[model samples]
Target: MPKNKVYIFDTTLRDGEQVPGCKLNTKEKIEIALALEELGVDIIEAGFPISSPGDFKSVSEIGAVIKNAVICGLSRAVQKDIEVAAEALKTAKRSRIHTGIGTSDFHIKSKFNSTREDILQRATQCVKWARNFTDDVEFYAEDAGRTDNEYLARVVEAVIAAGATTVNIPDTTGYCLPHQYGEKIAYLINNVPNIDKAVISCHCHNDLGLATANSIAGAMNGARQIECTINGLGERAGNTSLEEVVMVINQHHSLGFYTDIKTQQLNPLSRLVSDTMRMPVQPNKAIVGANAFSHSSGIHQDGFLKDAQTYEIINPEQVGADGSKIVLTARSGRSALAHRFQKLGFQFNRNDIDVLYEQFLKVADRKKEVEDEDLKVLANQYQTATV
Candidate 1:
């Protein structure tokens, strides 16, 4: 059977930059945009053009230089917002206008102080206005995770009719469980008559730490595009991580999905975004974290040394990361100690290691981790005693 193509829509410059103090200048945005193009992102959501003068300039600059990837500018359902986005994306080879309005009752009654019918009309109208500027238009139903599935389908169907090529169902508040998000996508696929006319997209947030899982669930059900960021950087918790979603589909072949992303660039691009945005990726972050491939636990280290596949599903070099590290710590066993010693050019026999293990444990217990210099001291002292 043929694998389905899952379009990677990267929103690092737009949504990911929304994190407080993670803002990027136009030069930084362009740099990341070109890298994202090289990384084979299908669509790069450059910025919200109407948000500010700086944002409009960034989107315009990114659109002018980004040739291969579809450069996209975001906007609200307002006409002025869509117009600004269209003007900003005028120089791109391929451009998309992403415009949408909130659909949930919380947004409808409290946020917009309007009824569902008015919001629905605004949603379709925005797509129509966006269609005037570009053939590629993506309509998002903000907070669709909490929206009624039936009403959400109506909004989706209307947007497609209004010339939306992609329909984004965002877990704006990150409120849905994996099952709920998947079932919601399935509901639209089953209920909407014109659903096949447009691609279903998953734009999930990581408030509950289920953004990646929810995105996968949506894809499994019917979504063909996943909107995500480089390092899961965004408002509140974060957005679905680009590395996580791409690697997940790569590892789980039974899902029968494939993306055009270059796997090796994941780490380099991740670090670039993290540094440029000044947001630190958590050490335990999946795929691109500092400790993602480092083994320190004695059981895990021994298993990893014996066979890398025993503890690591991903080879570090596969993602352009440095080789796996065997960090020596208090919990490390003799096998790990021997391996580290071997790496340091020491030819310790099993008996040599047996004697050194006692002293190594004493040093390890005194510190958080046993450094190479500490190991050398132990090796030298043991050799002196044996001689």
Candidate 2:
């Protein structure tokens, strides 16, 4: 409805901390809030204030100090929770009260033992209550992926009317496929009457290993904000990774959606979060992973040497990572060996390289990885003795 600017809503301190063994104290929360601001997030969902005293203190402190990004505190569809959230965010320059409840049949029956009508009423009342404190209120319909589209549309419309500035559609179970999630978002975009009044957001989990894909699909269909975490660390499998989503949008600006995220700061910020939270980023993750830019395949190494675009969609430098790495392995080619050898100051002609290539191959075949020491020994043997 508005300009195609995709808002990057980072929740690394809130839902991410909810993950078992990923708890963070107040100081750590503030540290991450500052880092998230520096990373250029539009909104930082700091924490659920009413969950605990420590959580409330962290939200309040972060709101007081963080001025660049919108500070948000989460609350359930209850009066006390909204009150706590409001109090916690009072010092924020720009504050949003994130309030909502589950709407799916399973959640309504099994989790809350409430009817659909009751859940809708509770959701609308909480949104209205949140609006009394701040004009910026975000309403989340938990488990929205499986919720009936007609009822979901009704809830979304009611929340918009009740003064919600943003509505979050959470794939709480991470059970929906990309196509199904995209259709769900599209259904809301087309069916909801007041959908344009508020921004549609996505909070996806990685249980099905499709969180990033589902988030991208939501944006393509019409969602404007993506709620994600650093290093893809969150509850269960994790949420969509902020770095992956930011890099994707940055590289493909023609998609008609872009964020304010600083691409070059992604890797450093990811490492900072991972280290502070003790959530090790998997080596093979898409954007900021240790091996995302490393090349080990012979064909891939050759293509990368000729042109980085042949293998990489975005330059590694853009995400604060080094250029393509030529890891010497049994699968490596002569181009890779020659490139690495030149880096070590070896000046070899085509004939000399051809002679050493065979030797290097033999050594590589015997070893799992070719080390610099092995290359040095090989280089020394091929040249005439001067000493």
Candidate 3:
């Protein structure tokens, strides 16, 4: 891949399914795995093989069938976990074993009850062990957001020297501000002696609603790959939203960064993940939301009617949306009213609109929203009354 090309590491099946009650069967996992592959994701984190038998089977089956994308299985910094990840990725045309340990002091002392030295040893050892299976090994410094930058750089250098081809810096708790996260990535890029030996990847969470921002900052600083879940689905608030990040890069051409994702497939893929997982995408959610292309406010609708570019920055078709929407509501202005009426085969001149305004306001006051059916009835009644 070119230096400017960002690789999309999709962890939808692994992290996305962590949403409570959003589990998928092996067949369902395969369905999504295949879709992700067709969507041109560079890597797919199938699942954590050591977490459950079903997950192991799903990862293994996904590895067996996916043709282009690298199939990855997550594991802890333990021999058995790495072994299971390797076993699960055996059939992949391209495979990766993603293994790592928590690096933040909070997780090191409270969660692992281990010293910094011990964790460092585990991080390198896991990479070395994973190398026995394949040359594609990614070491994640879980919770690196809060980890001391100097210590984080040390850990990154050690893992790269120990044969890890990709080093992941994850904001596990989503606590870092955008500048702070970007600075951390910059520190690693400038400080790590062997940094160029491995690809720097960002895996940001959304607890504080900054995952997408933090991920972008990471890329701007040095990280070349982004680990994201579809629709921002993951534990707690969720991971970085794939569609948001991709579109942000696309819309901001001056950023000079690009990804391999097919922009048009974003909406279809978002809906697929939502439907299969039974997770609802908020109607106003960015990118793939149902109302992303809809306009109802009077000013916004009037601007959109004259020219979509007035109120809309992105062309709806750019992300596969059918078209822009001018929804009729009490807040709608004459332009929107005229636009929708014209769509339904009605034409009204300036005097006619002024004449209809009184009746339209009456219906608008009576109902919460004036639908096309109601407007048609109003138009017919006006013709009768005038006749």
Candidate 4:
């Protein structure tokens, strides 16, 4: 891949499915995996093959059918896990075996009850084991956001030397602020001798509500691949939302990086994953949300009525949404009412609008909002009185 291109590694099937009660069967996983492929993600992290029989089956079947995007199967640092992942990805025309271990002292001491050196060795060995399957192997440093920058460079350097083509530095706990995470990636780029040999990937969580920010930081600071999930679905506060990151890069072209993602597919794919996974996307969620481009406040509605760009930075059509909306409500102003009136085939002058606005407000106060029909009723009443 070109250095200017940011590879989108979607783990909606792996980390996304980790959400409680969001478990998808093998068929559902394949259905979403196909959508992700068409959405233009560079890699699809299918599942952790060693975790269960169902996961292994999902990974294998997705690998068999997905011909475009690289199908990746996740595994821990254990030899058996690596072996299972490799077998599951054997059918992929393009495939990657993603394997890694924790590098931070917290995960080392508490999660593994092991030392830093031992964990580093396991991380290196896992890369070597994964490489036996394909040349496109990716190694993730779990909880990498908290891993010491100096020690993290050493771990990253070691894996790159072990034939790992991509190294994922993840904020497993979603703990790092944007600057702190960017500095970590920058540290590796400056300190690691063989850093150029592998693609640096960012996997961030949203526990701190900074996943998209941190992922953008990593990319701006030199990481080329971002591992994210659709609708931001994942453990706890969820993963970095794919739609957010993609749209951010789309809107901010000065960032000097681009991804192959079809921005239009983002909203549809987000809904597909949410529906198939049985996860309810928050109405106000970024990019793909129903209200992402909807305006309701009087001030906002007025500005939106004059020009959508006044309130919306992203055009709704850019992300596959229907379009911007000026939601009717008691808080809405006359400008909004007039715009709705025009849409409903009425053209009232300023004085005429003021008269209608008064009645609209009265009905809005009683009903919480004035519907289009109600606006027509109010407008016709004024016309009838004048006649």
Candidate 5:
């Protein structure tokens, strides 16, 4: 088989905005949509048109303005929703109306109080109605992580036959393990007869803190598109982080799958989304974290001083983050101390470095973090003692 290309479908404006208090107005959504295109995202899920007048307007305006990316709108498995979504996306240079219904037994019993036959019938009708507006229709099986594999395969086949160009298997509640999610995609691949007609997409949440892991598993199992949001911002736990998924594929190109994301833009893109959404990414979060490249430990600092690859897998520059900081701390070694002193315009001999390092360690033990002033003061004291 030829190498598969993974399409990045960004849902930051749709599912991401669904997070309470993270709602963005039309201007904010447009700003994010443009950034997504510049970041090389293939499709941007602009908004859910039928949910509110504001949402419908934003989706329409975004469709009108964004020319490079495939602008999309989300809708439920209802005729009205599909009509509204299609209308919103009609002006897009490239458009897709995503329509679907929940297929899990829990959703049928607790949410809709409907039977399996009724659910499948509704799902099939939505796809067909969406196809009436445009050829680019994507059908999602909401909460597919818990839906029976056999029935899910049936829905996949029905939607494809109904003219869906893409099929999304979403772990709506983030309930499945990585291996289980992979098996679900594989099951559809093996059982669905018309699966080849549509692209397989993965939409996993972060309720279990495994959204990125599950996405990789789905891709490894044959998914061609990965739906994500910046900083994993979404309802409840969150969605997969766009930077995490893109960097994973870049780092492991041996898998024979690649994304269109420009890796160097990951950091700036992350900051842009964070500022627009008013969502602060944690310092320890992977990829775009503040401390991802900073080193303070003696052993790690020594290795990093010799070669960054010894302590880091991905280079900070590769993701647009500033290079590693050889922090001066209680655990910092002699080389780190010397490096800091040299930057401060002081060159120390081997003996002077040893003395200054001992003093720096004691000062670091007192302060949580050492400042440049502290280093300079220590250097002055060392010079005075020698005189």
Candidate 6:
């Protein structure tokens, strides 16, 4: 991979499905896996094979069909988990086994009641076991955001030496700020002796609503892969949003990084995942959100009417969205109302709009938004009064 290339690792089938009530069956998982491939994701984490029989079947079936992108299965540091993950990925043209353990003291002491040395050994052994079945092995440091840098670097080095091709540093609890996460990635890059041997991946959560920001920070600090999900779906708040991160790297040229993602497929794929998982994308969410390209404020609408660049940084059509909307609300100005009417095929002049503006505002005040039907009624009422 090029130094500036960032790999897109989509874990919607595994992590995103972990969200409550977002469970997907084999067919749904395969549907998303194929779509992710078409969207140009570098890797698809099909499922955690050892978690359930259904998940095992989904991973196996997705691995069997997906040809271009690498199919991966999640596993713990346990031997059986690695074995099951390997079996699930047997049919993939490209396959990866992602296995790891907790490296943070909080998890080490509380979750496993083990010391650093024991955990480090377990991490190395798991990677070695994964290597037995496939060369594309990724090791994740669970709760790495909270793990101490020196100790984290040690485990990272040990894993790479043990045959891991990618190392994931996850902000498991969505705890780290951008600067903190960036510094952590930088620390590993500078301190780890064999850091260049494998790719550093960022897996951030959105509890603080900073998953996208933190993931960008990681990429800026030399992490080459971003682990994300469609529509930001995951356990708790969510993981880093795939569309948000992909667009961020694309729009900001100064970042000097790029991914293989097909930007135009973002919205359609977001909707597919949302519909398949029975989860609604928040209207206000970034990128593929319903309100992402909408102009509602009077000031914004006026500026957007004059020049779209003034209010919108991203074109709606760039991400497969319908188009920019001039939503008529009480906050809208006469310019926006005129624009909406013009779009509705009404040739209302400034004087005609001025006459109808009062009634438009009356209806706008009564309703949250004045629709085209309301504008037609107002226009007809104005023409009747004049006649």
TM per prediction: 0.99, 0.96, 0.98, 0.97, 0.98, 0.98
Global lDDT of each model? 0.94, 0.91, 0.92, 0.91, 0.91, 0.94
Q: Write the per-residue lDDT of candidate 3 for residues 71-142, one digit (tens) a residue.
A: 999999999999998998888999999999999999999999999999999999999999999999999999
- Candidate 4 residue lDDT tens string, 213-248: 999999989999999999999999999999999988
How far off is residue 39 in model 1, in Å?
A: 0.7
RMSD, candidate 2, Å? 1.8
lDDT by residue (1-387, candidate 6, tens digit) is 343999999999999999999999888888889999999999999999999999999999998899899999999999999999999899899999999999999999999999999999999999999999999999999999999999999999999999999999999999999999999999999999999999999999999999999999999999999999999999899999999999999999888888888889999999999999999998999998999999899999999999999989898888999899999999999999988888878888899888788888889899998888998888777778988
CA deviation > 4 Å runs, candidate 2: 1-3, 384-387
Steric overlap count per candidate: 0, 0, 0, 0, 0, 0
lDDT of 6 at 180: 100
Clash pairs, candidate 2, are none
In candidate 2, what are the lDDT values of residues 243-342, reduced to their tens digit?
9888778877678777988888888988888888887888899888889999988899999999888998888888898767888998988789889889
| TM value for model 1 | 0.99
- Runs in model 4 deviating more than 4 A are 1-3
Screening candidate 4 with a backbone cut-off below 3 angstroms (N, C-alpha, C), the clashing residue pairs are none
Candidate 1 residue lDDT tens string, 1-387: 999999999999999989999989999999999999999999999999999999999998888888799999999999999999999998889999999999999999999999999999999999999999999999999999999988999999999999999999999999999999999999999999999999999999999999999999999999999999999988899999999999999999999999999999999999999889888889999999999998999999889888999999998888888879888988999999998899889999999888899999899899998999999888888778888
- TM-score for model 3? 0.98
